[model samples]
Target: MLDFLNDILWGKVLIALLITIGIGFTVASRFVQFRYFGRMFRILGASQAFKHDKHGHLSSFQALLLSVAGRVGGGNIAGVAVAITLGGPGAIFWMWVVGMMGMATSFLECTLAQTYKQAEPDGTYRGGPAHYISRGLGARWNWLAGLYSVLLLVTFGFCFTALQSYAVATSVGDAFGVPVLYSGIALAVIVGMIIFGGVKRIAKVTEVLVPVMAVGYLLVAFVVLGMNLERIPDVITLIVKSAFGLEPMVGGGIGAAILMGVKRGLFSNEAGLGSAPNVAAVAYVPHPANQGIVQAFSVFIDTLVICSATAFIILLSSVYEPGSGVSVEGVALTQSALADHVGDWGRSFVSIALLLFGFSTVLYNYYLGENSLNFFSTDNTRLLNGFRVLIIALVCWGATTDLSTVFGFADVTMGLLALVNLIALLFLFKPGLRIMRDFDRQIAEGIEQPVFDVSRFDDMNLDAAAWEIEPEDLARIRQREAAAVAQGK
Candidate 1:
């Protein structure tokens, strides 16, 4: 049943839907992801992104880190290897394509997340596809929202967290001869401590770790590629040729490349999966588009930068013959390829990287689950506590057992999660575009920092607390605008 479901959902429905919706969003938004590409860096680097609000909401940068933590995980490494193994070198090219289109999909979904976000009792915010479907599309769509919440909870909150723990335990076991059981126990304990501290702690932990791990892994990749600089051209040529069926290798032709690339790319960056927007909605940005643009850049960092780094490391190695019949799958394939470049120590590096990647992802996934639980029943304290304990237990259990069947089931749920989110995005496309256009209009009018004015969107349902401007802040915005006008004249 799992295989049949996977084949039907992933092999056909999702690929077409994801591509079509992604392209539709890209076109409707006038390629906002590309048009505002440079500004994404400016938004992320601005002091506003780092500033903590009086209400204790997460800084925009912190929310970006949380989203990145979820994105830059084991998939960037082991998953890329699997793509190449099954789909050939051409898969890397298609992954880039998916990442590009996904930027627009991510932008649309996250903007809607912020626009429709609900103010929580504790002063934080909660929203995602579930909130937007119910609020943006109207209460009649509440059933669909509830369905999305359940799918997200099962796919990300529970199953994926266990899989992340398993990846970490497996890597540690391989790298240091430590038992998987021991690693699992240690991971559960550490994860419990951080999670218990709540979302703020998760944000802090990821803020420090995401940059370190991503930069560290990229540095190693650069070194490996530098050592084999002469081979760079050949690898690039191979990827392009294979992508177009010009180079027939391991996984047959263009069809395999497109399939594996889109699959693993979605898994790695999570652009349209609706998971990132859960964290994105938690941010305190002046405008919804600010967080949306920041998140689109994250998809680039995850797939184009981090995942591409892994692909290059593998393809540039002596061990990575296109038709090589060697059965070194997943992380082992990556480790073997790296070992060929930098010696036995290369294997250990991949292991440590995977461990960090997997650990951070668990934290991100746990928060998404928590957020979804809040959507169902915010007052259910006992239920929330039990859910935490359940997650820890699942992590430990997953580490000690083979969950291939369970993981396949997760794939089905994940696909369903994307399906629901993409359909909702289609329903809310015009509203999302209106928000983006408002931001662009502000920029064109010489507003240095765009601020969302809820008054303009009176026809649309929105949480005023999320977008309302204080009088003092409004005064400051006016002063800045006046100064800009005077200077321009």
Candidate 2:
């Protein structure tokens, strides 16, 4: 029954829905993801020094790191191996395609998350699909919000945590002969210490760890690619031809290639899955679209940069056999490919990388669930505490056991959550577009910094306090605009 449901939800329904929504948002936003690519970096660079916000919001860079922590995980390593094994080299091409389209989807949902965000009692910001669904769509749609929250809680909080833990434990056990039980207990303890510190600690830890892990991984990949520079063209050609079933090596045909690519691509980057926006909304930005654009760049980094690294490593190696009937799945396959290229130490490197990737992912997933739990009952400390304990338990359980069943169940839940989020995104896309336009207009008019004016959204169902501009800052912005206007004249 679980397999059947997963096949229906993820295999059939979601593949089309994810593609269509991605394309729709891309077109609707006039390819904002592409147009603002340079600005994305500018915003990120400008946000490096964390700003102190009285509302307890994270700086934009911290938020970007948080989302990237979730995006670049075991999926980038193990998931890429699985895609190549099943779908052939052509799967990598499809992954790139979905990632490009998913960037736009990410932009839309994250912008909505920022637009409808609200303040929490603890002086932090809270928003996501649920917050936007209830706040943007009005009270009548609160049920949809609740549904999204519940699905998010189940998918990320429980299932994904287990899956991440399992990946780490399995990899470490395979590499070092460590017992899964010990790894599970250690993972649980480490995760508990960070999560218990709350969102601020998670943000701070990821801000440091994400950069180190991602850059280190990419640096190693560059070395490998440099070693195989002559085969780069052949690898690229193989990927493209395999993607369209033009290559005979892609035994499963075009259909399997598309499925594997889209599934793992979405899983790796999480562009349209509605998970990233929960963190995206926690950033303090001059405009809602600022964070959205930052997140769009994250999709690029995850799929095009990190995931491509994994693909290249495998494709450039002799260990990858496209037609072999032997099963080489997940992290083990990745480790084998690296080991083939660089020796036994390569396997140990992969295991260590997986530990960092999985641990950070566990933290991000926990925060997503905690945020959703807050939506149900903000005052229910007892319930929130209970959920945290449950999350820790699930982490340990996942480490000690096989999670094939857990993964299947998570796929179904995640598909439903994505469906709900995509629907909300479609409904609220225009408002997000308006926000983008407003931000663009400011940039075009030579404003170095764009600020959002809540007055522009007076007719909409937004929390005024969320977008309130301080008088002093508002005065400074007006003075700059005035100077720019005079200079134009």
Candidate 3:
């Protein structure tokens, strides 16, 4: 049964859907991901990203860290390993494609999350699929809302929780020869302590870790690549060729190459999975759209930058070989390739990285689940506590056992989420488009400037008391937009 499910997941149907949606987002957004590429890094580096509210929660960067915590985890490190092993090096290319397009997908979803956000009893704000669906989707056919919540609980909350713990335990077992059980217990304790403070604490942890890990891993990979600089040209050629499925002659064709690239991208960055937006919703950005844009950049950063770096390290390493048996599959394969260059220490290093990535992901996933459950009932405090405790138990369960089943379950769940999220975006598209246009106009006209601060409505309309946006800013942006539209005519 597991074999059959794995076959289906690794086979065409699911792949087609994932690829199609990625392309769909890329096309529908008119390649906004590419058009705005240069700004992503600058936006991330801006001090505004790290600014915080007095009582609301963490800063935008903190929220981003928490979100990155979920995303950049096991996948960036271990998941890359999995893709190359299963789909071939071509899979990494596809992952890049998906990450590129997923920017807009995440932008749309996170904007919607912010757009339809609701205030919680604790005086903090929360929003995601459920909130957006109920608001933009309306209260009428709430059955779909209910179903989405359940899916999130199962996928992001429960099943994924198990998968993350497994990654942690496996990494530890490989690195230090620690028992998986011991790793599981440690993970549970760490998660429990951090999650106790909610998203803020999670964000604090990830904010420190994400950059360190990303940089540390990249430095290691770059060092390896530098040692083999002579082979860099050939590796690049292979990547391009493998991406086109034209080199090794193993794939169906260039079409297969592109298709695989897109598949890996979506799986790696998870733009439209409706997961990242949950974190985005909690971020206090100028406009919901601003958060959306920042998140779009994140997808690019994750798949295109980070994931691609991992692929290069493994492929460029001298010991990399199909025959090496280190990467019998994905993440493991990456570990082996690194070890070939770094010695046995490489395995331990990979394991430690996975541990950080997986635990951070678990923390983020817990919040997602909590938000989903919160939509059902605010009084479910007891339920929420129990849920957290149960997840802790599952952490232990995940570590000791092979994660084939849980990973299978997560794949199915993500597809189901994409369908609902995309549907919500259907209603959300008009508003989203307006903001995209407005933001672009503001930036182009110099009225809004690059940061495009819109934290409150008054910022966009200065006449409005609270979030007073300067009229000069608004008029300048409008005039430019008109001129651009006229030029198009």
- Best candidate, lDDT-wise? 1
Question: How high is the CA lDDT of each candidate model?
Answer: 0.88, 0.87, 0.70
Worst-scoring 10-residue span by lDDT in model 3: 459-468
Question: What RMSD does each model have against the real structure?
Answer: 1.8, 2.2, 5.8
Q: Which pairs of residues collide in candidate 1?
A: none
**lDDT tens readout by residue for model 3, 92-180:** 66676667657777877886776666655554677787777776666784787788888888988988899888878877887788999
- If both were scored by TM-score, which would come out higher, candidate 1 or candidate 3? 1
Please, what is the TM-score per model?
0.96, 0.95, 0.85
Top candidate on TM-score is 1
Ranking by lDDT: 1, 2, 3
Clash count, predicted structure 1: 0
lDDT of 3 at 415: 61
Instruction: In angstroms, give how far residue 117 of model 1 lies from its true place.
Output: 0.7
Q: Whole-model lDDT, candidate 1?
A: 0.88
Candidate 1 ranges with C-alpha deviation above 4 Å? 47-52, 470-489
Q: Model 2 off-target regions past 4 Å?
A: 48-50, 325-327, 471-489
lDDT of 3 at 57: 52
